[model samples]
Target: MGETYGLLSLLPIAVVVITAIITKKVIEPLILGTVVGAILLYGFSFFPNWVGDLLATMSDPDVVWTMVIPALFGILIAMFGQSNAGTAFRELAIKYVKNKQNSLLATYIFGIIIFMDEYMNALLIGGTMRNLTDKFKVPREVLAYVTNSTGTPVSVLLPFSSWAVFLMGLYGSSELLDGDGFTTYLSTIPFMVYPMITLIIVLLFIFRKVPMTKYVKEAVARAEKGNLFPEGSGPDTEGFEDELEENSGNTKKPRLINFVLPIIVLVAGTIMFDMDLIIGVILAIVTCFILYRLNGTMTYSELFDTSVKGIQDMVELIVLIIAIFLLVRVNENLGTIEYVITSVEPLITPLLLPGITLLVVAFLGFTTGNYWGTMGIVLPIILPLTQMSDVNTSLVLGAMVSGGVFGSHVCFFGDAVTLTSASTQVSNMSQIRVSFPYALAGLILSFFIFLGLGLIV
Candidate 1:
């Protein structure tokens, strides 16, 4: 067996993490980490002849294609941009974002409404408000803050979200009204600490003049003076046709259908067939060509031409996805994630469980930068509570999720963290620095909350 603690096993992981932090790029770190691991396992004294096997595994098409589908799914979205779908969507959003106060309050209100599902709320609110939020220069993190804070707050309180279904699956209903374990799960929704506290914090941040950061402040200052950020970014007519191929924006209204129809296929197909997101996205990209042909946006030859054009639109987003993946992978391989989890387990105790849960989950989120993984582990493990008959599982699970989300909101390395930063054009550090105080306050309040919860339950 391989030595878990030896330098050979750790070198790859170390390089990956250090490089990721310094460069803030994901794919390069991931590729480099894998290469290092292969080197360690195959250095002359090691499995010298096994280099081929290691290489084959790393080159596995599945690894590359996993993201391909989601990327394609993203392309389907690009079609919308090329046409008029995005403009239509923006018009609808503007009606809602009417003003900053409306935008901020709406962010909270929707956060509460999307209670039935966390992921749905995340994408729906985040994507929908991209235009409006950008117009307001509301710092992508604030949108993230609102989306994240509300996503869980509502889910934990509502019995209809994926969590409810998960609990139902975990503890099959006994049929009677109160006999169902899910009901206990549902009742505990109020007990969820971090999300609830986070909701309150967002409300205050919105109503109060809580200065966020220089960039956020800049956005606000501009908005106060009535200005907007760059629009139709990523790529443009000049960027694609003039810069890339010397073509011009000739595709017309048909372009709109080319976008909408493909997205319907992607979202509907992915959700209905439960297809992998990456696969669904890829298919959507292909669909764009087919639809373009059918709708007259391009002929077969032009298909290749505009395909390049359409892809250019998503170039920044694609780069972001790859970078995020590499960084995430490298960090995982390095053992930083492992150390984060085990190091704090021993520190957990009954009296300290609530506060510690926040700290530990925050650290776990920082290390793994995962919202779901933190919940899965902390909720199941943690101190002496797995066997306690008197202890309510709801309170426990809530604390875990709350703490996890708190960390995720600020973890400069996590997916959501990166997504918010990249989409908003703010440096990752700016998002982190701006959001930290809010997350910390939520963590503190949640600690006391679980303390009171401990007695009530």
Candidate 2:
């Protein structure tokens, strides 16, 4: 910021992007970047400076809100697991799914419907649909594709999701934004081009309107011969199968009410609470407690244990959130965004902002395999730039969202891809190879759409 670094202001970000890509990890790179930025800012005294700044970041109200909300959603999800509601919902839906085509379609639809969280969506859809898809001779790659495609994209696009709440909290908490986060998020919905296009592409592929890649075609052909994967070539389960079995096993048959009622409370309560996601999730948890208790699905001790386990389940996410906040603070000190804007401002017009934002964020998201982390770094930068340039706020925000989802959709090492691969027992690389072309197609279309809209709107 003080011309101490000039172009070197970008060093930390470069370290983060490059390290993340090379190592296929997010937290370590983010931490390393933060350390690098801190050193750049405070020289030999970086340790205390870093700790102070990180503590400040951790204590920020919005950061606390972000941390709390995800844990709450985890609790709600755990409750859903205890109720076997996802299984119930799956059982109910699979009743009508009689073939490969319908099985894929049903997986896609369920992926969208289970929009509360991406992890839940990936695991639920992949785990529940795997046997059915296998029965119908659908390749694991295909199942992985449908599951991964719908995971982050749909979760981010919809308002009721953990992704949405986290994003909205980020937007509203930014001092650059004057509008309410929920309203701003709703405004971005229509312009979120990538997810909509990706969903359409999935639908087209499901209906056989889109041609499969040769690899996918080969996989499909193999599946038709009753081989879901090449012998010994599937991903190492790494205990995922056992984890899934442990989590999903229920002696009692899954009741539809156990699945449907809590979700209804969540959505309806959120709306009733004026879009307060935390309260909404709390209400849903309470509803789950009562419903499960009345139905004897869980005793008080079991319920409490599940609640604690749920919070435990979210520790990794919470740690990532903390690291993201730390990196953001370090970047602020390094003036990373400030340097970027100064260098790019003369070259970038408002008409180019949306498309450029999409491309840049998409590249970052894909390389980092951390969509939320990427957004945490860029949103602070982009929001300020948008205000200065007078670009359409929602348009640019939409592009940002679209780009993040695009990256998550195709990145082989991304959480969604990893989880889906593990859940469906396909190699992570195999799913990415199968899904990349379609994701790329959507990316191209989204970039053009953003460009045109930037010109017109």
Candidate 3:
């Protein structure tokens, strides 16, 4: 462990955080940070080392699983979009969404229902419900907030999701824990304070039991005056607008089954396959293809084209995830987590471990904009600390998971934020600014909850 570069090990991630915040970009900063880490470790010969790490990280099985599952979901979502499934579902839900509060309620409900993955939740809910929210004079920021809030928070809280599966895989492989990964994860569910609290806050805001931040309040005022999108406040959504237009042109009467059946297959298949999301996603895609083909909604050629387009759309995000994996590898080689543990080891007693873990992991998650990557880096370090101090492992583990969700929730460049912005047509920065206050509230509340629980348990 002393082979670590000590204090210097912090350089790479610091570079990422500083550059990311300054530029409000994700991939470029990630790449630059990895390069900085490589240079720190290998000097001028860093090129070969960086390339090797990049290749190895890209080929990692877990990394592959993460990338592949989302890409498959992308293809499935494209099919759903092309077949007007989301539109059909939106129409069904719109009946109950006759007012502003009802629209928020409907969006919140659908966001929870599509909890297989954050990506799916954001894409489906934001795309499907934006128009409904718009009709009720709800700001796109509010829609983005509802969509983004429910995205990771819901997925992480639910045991049967890509988030839980990925975390379990990480925990399962760790030598520090004694139980099966799935069961251990289930143990942490009740203590996952940040996400659970976040969901509660989202509900409170939805029902007007809690006042929104000034940004959201202002946006709401703007929205009620016939401006659903604040000027210069969102992404360039012409492409999505075109897609929505094409979806609206579907000649067949929109059947609710076209939307609901594939998702049912996804959820049921996942349960049947021992919670492997890949199988569920593939099953959903196949179900969509067969259903669409038989219904004459899309031809074979059209289905193939849409499938390919979906994969193409995911290419950029996949590359971003790969960049995140590369940074994780660089951190490992630099012994970043080891350095952190070593530097802080003396202060990490049993009583403070959970709170400190949450703060540390949350900072890493926020700065890096990669919850899984941050978890991969920190959990190994955390498990050893939990073991050494005889702390309640489940409590600290819950804090770690909560911190990752908080980071993902608040990070401006996180994939959830980007997806929500795209689907809701809200700007990425604007979404972050609008949601950060709420996210911070969750973080502060969760920190105390972990601390209190640590002392009690």
Candidate 4:
């Protein structure tokens, strides 16, 4: 259960990736990985006991709270779409964004502006922009890619975001760091090559400078043929479209206020009240309901049903998140992360440490599908290594952040990917397949950037 197992602790992650590639499925691989990790942690005799422990961990108040925030956000998104606020916004956006290029650009801008929380950014922006992107034949996969890439990357880059606050606390508490944690975080910003490069890469895609991948090209081709989704690959929006149609018969017009005001309340509430994302979303949902009802846009019963429908739409994503949480728990109990760090200790040097740490953290984050968890486990270990190895602290810190961002963007089961898929109504695997090449391109670029910085800094 500790670092005593050394390299053997990596078997679970290997199992996950190999199984996933072979099966082309995520849930089974994740479950298999978790079970293997449990067996490794507790042995054959206590394997049943480990399952009980995992369940108990998943039910912890903090864990449940984290899970609920996304579910509530899902409800808010569903309400937006159901109330035709998303449609209204799309119509409004189309006025300024007359073509595919401007539509994608507009989506990216919204992602940057909603940087307070990654989950909110993905759900709100993805939901609002999907119809607009559809109008221009900009493929759901492309929309998913834009929303997914910008979600975590933008949050990590912004100083006022949840990511920054969590990282500040992490760095502040670390004995290895010498200066104020906030200042140290700020210093690492310039060296955060991955997210910065990721944004640039997205911009290139928006401007049509980057070539579309095969999947994206196919998606675009299909859209040109008047197909919104590839054959057999659309979200289960059975009741969603029906509800929107029913609401269309109402006398109230689809004003931009229905879309804009709720988001303002959600963002402002989060910052001003220092509220949890769940609270902010709850307030937004209430505001949307009040506005829609007062304007006679939707009946009270219709609003309640649509909100529930929205929550139902996110059921798959919520389940994926819980499964991932269990996988993370199993990884912790198996000490997989600790093994990776300690195994790399003997090979690290001042010049190579930054690039090496970035790779290792990236591997862990990609495997675990939880970048925040990767950071929590990795920074504590790698920061101490940097203190003793004569490495440039800021560069190493930047590398860690870069790796986390890259992993979040690429991992198929990562929260950002799942949430983006759910919000944009694209399948999770479709989003990953289309976006993998681009993410890899960024990762390769980041590795070289870090390697050069490692030598100079």
Candidate 5:
């Protein structure tokens, strides 16, 4: 971060944000940004042969490993989906939950279970439950809410998650804290106000049978009128007949064991083996094939083709993740991240940490507009702060995650929001209109909880 052409260092970050805005796609923007960053690195003499170095580094095993695992997970999901396995799963889940509320709850339950990573949780749950919720008139925003609420906090709390590993490395390097990874991460979980409150909010909505928000309410009404898109998508009169045709003929008779047995296998396999999620996901995909084969859903080659196609659909997401990673990395190099952390660190008292952290996280989340990117930047700062306060690290980490999810929840511009809007076939504004108020409510509640914990700790 030497000052000569320091401004140039920020070009890549800017490139990404601007590209994301203009193209509304991630892969190309990131790759372009990487090239720009390489040029800057060369011009600034940041490294010897920096341009070549950066290009080589782009394909580094660490970088590629990050790409492969998430992409692999996406591939597995795509496979299951394309093979009509997900459609079959949906048909079966419909039989069990019959009630929409229960169906939503089941989503919450699995969202909590897939705590190994946030991105994994977002894509996996969204892919699996998309059709089921669609069948029951649930908005994709609600599903996004469920995924966002559960993903981050659960990972922060769970020792085995990639979040834990990164936090350990970041915090461990800071010289601000001295401790083992387990103690450090565990100490921060309770203070993660957003996810905790989010879970509570979800339960309240389900248990109280809360009516959907106004936009969501309208979304539902439109859905029932046989239109999932906004009324402008050809309106429903002539369109409804065609939509009915799209949904009608392929509805498979529900298979109890086809769904039940595989889920049991998946849950059991992950827990019993204490598996890495890549392995865990691979196991799940394998289970899909086995169940499909057993239940006579598709022949072997068709399963392979569907899985490949499913994985292809998520290429956009994989590119987004990779690009977001580079954007955060550039932020780190540009000193913007450090400037914010240093300027804000002293502002945090035991009492004020919760509110301030949440506020700051929201701002970062909004600017970066990425949950994982937000967490990657913030965790390094807060992990050390927890030691400074001599507080419970888990609670502090919880607050960190809470703040991130809080921002991402309302960020209609984020990848998750985009995907939710896509799957629901709803307008972006519709997702925003519905998610914002809900996000605000959850944010306020989570802030108070963090304040309470900060006071107590």
Candidate 6:
């Protein structure tokens, strides 16, 4: 679409990032950037045409399916709260996870277990564990860091996940790869250094092996003083508290099954049927309705009402996801990534390609706040580059995955970051400010590791 724009193609991405940083609001910037991209692509006369295109894109069955799944999952999350299952789980967690170290460890473990979808992982874990972590004076930011770290990283590492399936599709369709897409993806797992090292960093934080950033330190200190969140550091948790109180009044005791059974159904259904996450979550939601109704904890009407409320809760995030999709379409049309890659192609060497690819993908992810988009744009380009050079294909592929994870992990306006913050009640910028140092550490470590591996392999 941007056969003639060249470097001017990057303006939309620049507008998105700069506007987001200045305004601390994601939706407006994303919409604005998308409109700007449309204007850039088709000129002043195409605004009406662009509107038609956006409507068509958003209404496409595949787009609607992807957008609705996360929102449906949100209903399951809210069901947990409505059933008081989250509170019951928290009480159980408090019984066993007594100290800060164990709480952090448990958080990490749960994050890893919910690896099928990053959105579900962040929302479920962050929501379920925030109160527990606060009991031990662990900042919401720390909870966010732990939860966010395990999300996309774990999803990409685990071959059974949606992320793996998506990557496999990308590879299978590409002309460069020789073997089965699933096989290639499994092979690349071990070499995903950014995600691997990022997990290590989380462990170090849990074990007190790594020094906390200044912001994190202040958060910890404030939390120790019984202030779970620093003043003005995050959003209000009053709505969450009210929701919990409303649910906790149910006469029936909250059972752990309310939490465990649904997650089991979700995960197991996905694995057993080789299905999309939407199907697993749908099965889980049906299971929840039966269990809750049969146990006298919720009536059919109340369950229906609560499920609607849950979907309502996710409306903002759903809109944000749609905006991200639109922005991605805009970038695709603008050829921003093509311009970026071609601009840097001449300077790449076999020894430097891995590191450079990692940096470039990470930069794109950071700027675009869209990991899937970054991977979609960069992988095809980078994979071909690797085949033409003396580069190790697996290592380069690993770097690509790592860079996407790194960007999603650290990008302030990223979907994962925003989801984690909302789930934990932390402000977007607060989470970003606290987690940036750790993400930076992982990025630097990955860059050097890939550079060395590129040279050796």
- Which candidate has the highest lDDT of all? 2
**Across residues 1-457, which tens digit of lDDT does each residue of candidate 1 receive?**
2225344445655565566556655556545665665555445543443345444433444334422433343345334434433334445446767666677676666556444445445544555455666665564556666666666566656544444444442232111114444445655567667776677777877877565656556656655564443223232311112322211132354333554566566556556654344444556667877776666655676555555654564454344334333333333344433444455445445555555666777766666554443443344334234233335555665666667667667777765555444434444565566678777777777788778877766
The 0-to-1 C-alpha lDDT of every candidate, in the order given, reads: 0.52, 0.84, 0.80, 0.74, 0.59, 0.76
lDDT of 4 at 129: 84
Q: What is the lDDT for 339 in model 5?
A: 48
Q: Which candidate tops TM-score?
A: 2
On a 0 to 100 scale, what is the lDDT of residue 308 in model 3? 96
TM-scores for the candidates = 0.52, 0.95, 0.85, 0.68, 0.69, 0.75
Residue-wise C-alpha lDDT for candidate 5, range 395-421, written one tens digit per residue: 666666677766666666775565444
RMSD, candidate 1, Å: 9.3
Sort by TM-score, best first: 2, 3, 6, 5, 4, 1
Model 6 CA deviation exceeding 4 Å by range: 59-62, 114-152, 155-191, 211-252, 325-342, 360-401, 404-436, 453-457
Q: Which pairs of residues have clashing backbones in candidate 4?
A: none
lDDT of 6: 0.76
lDDT over C-alpha atoms for residue 165 of model 3: 66
lDDT value, candidate 1, whole model: 0.52
Instruction: For model 4, state the Cα shift of residue 74 in Å.
Output: 1.6
Residue 61 in model 4: lDDT: 57
Instruction: Kindly report which residue pairs in candidate 2 clash with one another.
Output: none
Clash counts for all predictions:
12, 0, 1, 0, 19, 0
Query: lDDT tens digits, residues 106-163, model 2?
Result: 8887887789899988887887778778778898988999899877788988898878
The segments of candidate 4 whose C-alpha lies over 4 angstroms from its true place after superposition are 1-7, 98-101, 110-152, 155-192, 205-253, 315-318, 325-342, 357-441, 452-457
Question: Candidate 5 — worst ten consecutive residues by lDDT sum?
Answer: 232-241
Q: Model 3's lDDT to the true fold? A: 0.80
The model with the greater TM-score, 1 or 5, is: 5
Q: Which pairs, if any, clash in model 3?
A: 234-427
